[model samples]
Target: MGLRLACRPLKPIDARRAREYAKHAMPSVHLTRHLYTFFPHLEGQHLIVEASTAGEVVAALEKLAPGIGFYICDERGRLRTHVNIFVGKQMIRDRKGLTDAVAADDEVHILQALSGG
Candidate 1:
């Protein structure tokens, strides 16, 4: 006998509501003060962005500071060499893809690496 898996598709109305909720739900993003050394305007501020994925959050941030995306990610959209992002206490796994899922109340932290002679 073959095993059958049960799966149910969401109804159109349900799907629409889910999309609406995802669009309205916002995540809190925190940027390290060190980044302000590079972009003064972004200093000491917390931003709320409606995003379900790490990449979307970055895109939302780009709206606040043009070219900020380049600092966090490379031209190809992969994470840059000196930037690190964490959701709560865990580091994101897909730095290149930024596919990590973020909850509405999740805290996203953006940090810039520091080097000294």
Candidate 2:
């Protein structure tokens, strides 16, 4: 059986906070080769997303590489089962909302899970 995460919607980032986030130092995002293969334009490019939350980071990645957000997240905005995101060295704790905080200079690595024994 498949698992689902249900919760209240995320709060909207206010205009002022959005502006502040714009000014905040951006974090570096590194996706696995598979993603780059599908979104060729994002290959050989710097992906620095300006945001404080992982969800926002995904949004920025989507802007850089269209349709990527859909690939990483489901319709309700929860991260897909096959995707794993790491902020620095630790795997993210808030998978449902992706509310995990990401600071500037943090390395965000998006890795697709490998299966089959």
Leading candidate by TM-score: 2
Worst 10 residues of 1 by lDDT: 37-46
For model 1 the TM-score comes to: 0.74
lDDT of 2 by residue, 93-114 (tens): 8888999999887999999998
Best by lDDT: 2
Ten-residue segment with the worst summed lDDT in candidate 2?
17-26
How many clashing pairs in candidate 2? 0
Local error of candidate 1 at residue 5 (angstroms): 55
Alpha-carbon TM-score of each model against the true structure:
0.74, 0.76
Q: What digit string (tens of lDDT, one per residue) describes model 1 on residues 1-117?
A: 999999999656688888888667779999878767777877766689888899999999999989889989998999987888999888888988999998997999988888888
Report the C-alpha displacement of residue 58, candidate 1, in angstroms: 0.6
List where candidate 2 sits over 4 angstroms from the true fold: 1-24
At residue 98, give the lDDT of candidate 1: 98
